[model samples]
Target: MPSAHTKSPRAASRTPLIEVTKLSKVYVNDAVETPVLFDIDLRVQSGEFMAIMGPSGSGKSTLMHILGFLDRPTHGKYRFLGKDTAGRTDDELAIIRATKVSFVFQAFHLLPRATVLENVMLPLLYHPTIPSAERQHRAQAAINAVGLFERTNFLTSQLSGGQKQRTAIARSLVTEPQVIFADEPTGNLDSVSGIQVMGALEKLHASGHTIILVTHERSTAEFADRIVHILDGRIASDSRSHSRRSSSGLTSLK
Candidate 1:
């Protein structure tokens, strides 16, 4: 396991966009306490592509939850863009998540009755700072980026599996967040669809978006620059790849 203080010389010299120290999470039910994560320490530089991989019950999901700010840790500290998240209130966390983080899931999670454009515009509903016209413009751009501009008027249910997932990706990207947390993004798609989705993600990574992917698939993990393997609530390995540059000059493992 890598310690916060033991970063490689290359890593030590860089400023981290996301940092976690001694992170742990425990679930308790009826006085039965089970720890889902141990003392995990991690640092992700801006625009880095990372994959968090593990077998079932290895606490990868728990770690993802923590990383996404969807769940709090039992102990340890999280700092985002140099701000400590340890004592932040739920409202504060929500604000941070809304402005800084975006999420992609295996399930499209689109509103079945909504058009592709409308679904992509969902995040803007919570952002009072963006004017309606700007929201629409950004939404259209995101949809276009995902190659779904032609289907913007079609309901999510009218699309094929890959198209639906593409719409979902557009929605996540609509926010223009600093970080994207994706959990099994290709799990529900066929091989071809998965490849298309991965290609889309690769484009985003190239555009300097920080991405953290949670997956069990080796092939999927290979898309990232760095791979962090977890097991039994602990980190097993953190490996880097050779092809380390994204299109935007973002570092990748391989």
Candidate 2:
């Protein structure tokens, strides 16, 4: 039997940026335990675009939360950038989450009152290491990357749904994170808007940013180089897409 940390032979030479081994999560209240994720094993290489697809109750969001360091797993190992996160402190995890990983959500979690540029600069506030003067430059570059430069001075409320999503993406990029976790980025947008959002993400991927997307829509998942299907808290299938092959032509999630 394969161990919980198993990887395909084809991926042996490449180092995984994020590795999850026998990972599981459970919610406990009043001494009652509810398992939300099974013994999940996954490995994501740097610069790869991956999508996690599952129905409403399949635990995809739970998995993303755990992987993104927003929540901890009840059991198993989660290694980020080759460091095991089993006993890390919350502050340590927070630093890693803030600096190395970024997240975009379905709700577009932007401050309605803030301008698009301000919202994009929000992540830099937590990153004290970035010089104050450099923050604006980075934020502006991020907004431009998402094609929202024209709306940077506009209040977030003034932007369209697609532009709001772009601002969210811009905020995520302000930190120049190594990985991005997007949960239903286009969930609230129309088909055309969703396509634009996906296009922005695809452009990011082309720029060598690793992305993990969680979506129920097959059309959205099609943007990923590889897709993992989850069913009842377990991975049903992990496969590469013929339409989005990697540069090496060996993108495999086994």
Candidate 3:
């Protein structure tokens, strides 16, 4: 249900970035079937901030995996940008995941020995389209987006937990994805660091990146424009909320 204060869904006029209907997932290991998601239906419009919140073992992770193209649904129809994704091959999906979508997780996933700039530039190394001469400039721009320009040369191992996560964000942005899947991005940080990371996410949203966050914290979920709750492999509630907490701790990257 829409809250009384909930405005119409963001980017209502924009094309849908993702659409899924009757989506289901089941694992068959040694012929032992284990169902994970059931008859799920969801649509995400372009330029929106959405958060998926649920307790452990509630199938949120599985749902995210399917949504992010990491795992395939056993039965369902999924469309990306109005095109059916059901017929896509593994290589096609990989190409989409590599060039169109990005991910940020609780783990920093940075190289201890690599400087922040090098780490951010890593993705372009595999991209056949990017010119080597432009990679550094692109990487620097991403680091600036996440407010890590000053630390561009710092080693990942020497940074604080929050800084490391921001570095991860920079890496995610280097590819210029249309959508980002952030799974428990704040799970490993302290309270202050968590707020900073969330603030960074908010800043990104303001810049027109579609954000899909999965978290167990209400405070973090509240940051998003809408929240979807999952329980027992089913969606319990899907509602819009405009309750973004104050980004008081935000710092200027400039």
Candidate 4:
């Protein structure tokens, strides 16, 4: 029998959720152009777990920003769900981000004084369509998914590093986006805490969420089924290979 992590044939055949062709990014300051990424072509399929790995100057973080619609590429054809995003205005991009994109970062960014439940529901507060009354219900569902339900009502300041990260994951999941961008999510964590977070991400992938993780650590990238490496602002390699220790072997921190 196929496991939950297995993508259905139908899913495999669908149009890629993200397609970037000849993508390039250049920053302009005082009329000077600083090139960051160049002619990058990539496709991210639905239900795939992929990691982007690179050193500090490789521009991976910039690529992540472009992928997440948090920033726009200077030149490229970027299609999300087969529709071109080149013409989208800043507000349109913001709408799309709010409605269809999820982000997890190294910084927990949770409200220090807010309860876990409140922090998780913060995204919904800005959503224009999600009913106010349904906010709590949706937040609860996301908290449960990340296995942070036990800490739902606890203040974020009271949580440990791992717990805080879990809370952040739940918060990101609250919007229920199709793709998730994790930017060096374990950068601030210790080994044990990192394992817990990776397992949580693996469980998310097993549940069919498309995960696009950005990391500088090989150990962290191993958790992904596919690893794409960037060097000097260009793709050095993209291998669907990993040396991940078995996920089942790790004791889940949540």
Best by lDDT: 2
Best by TM-score: 4
How big is the positional error of residue 96 in model 2, measured in Å on the Cα after superposition?
0.8
Model 2 Cα lDDT, one tens digit per residue, 78-142:
99888898888999888888799999999999999999999999999988589889999999999
Cα lDDT of candidate 4 equals: 0.86
Q: lDDT for model 1, please.
A: 0.84
lDDT values, one for every candidate:
0.84, 0.87, 0.86, 0.86
Any idea what lDDT model 3 has?
Answer: 0.86
- lDDT (C-alpha) at residue 237 in model 4: 90
Alpha-carbon RMSD of each model:
4.7, 5.5, 3.2, 3.3
lDDT of 2 at 158: 94
Cα lDDT tens digits for candidate 1, 142-215: 99998988999999999998898888889889888989988898999987677778878888887888889999
Give TM-scores for every candidate, taking all chains together and pairing residue i with residue i: 0.90, 0.91, 0.92, 0.93
lDDT of 4 by residue, 78-154 (tens): 99998999989999998888878888989988888899999999988877788899999999998898888888899
Q: Which segments of candidate 4 are over 4 A away from where they belong?
A: 1-12, 252-254
TM-score of candidate 4 relative to the true fold: 0.93
Model 2: CA > 4 A from native: 1-11, 244-254
Residue 184 displacement (Å), model 4 = 0.6
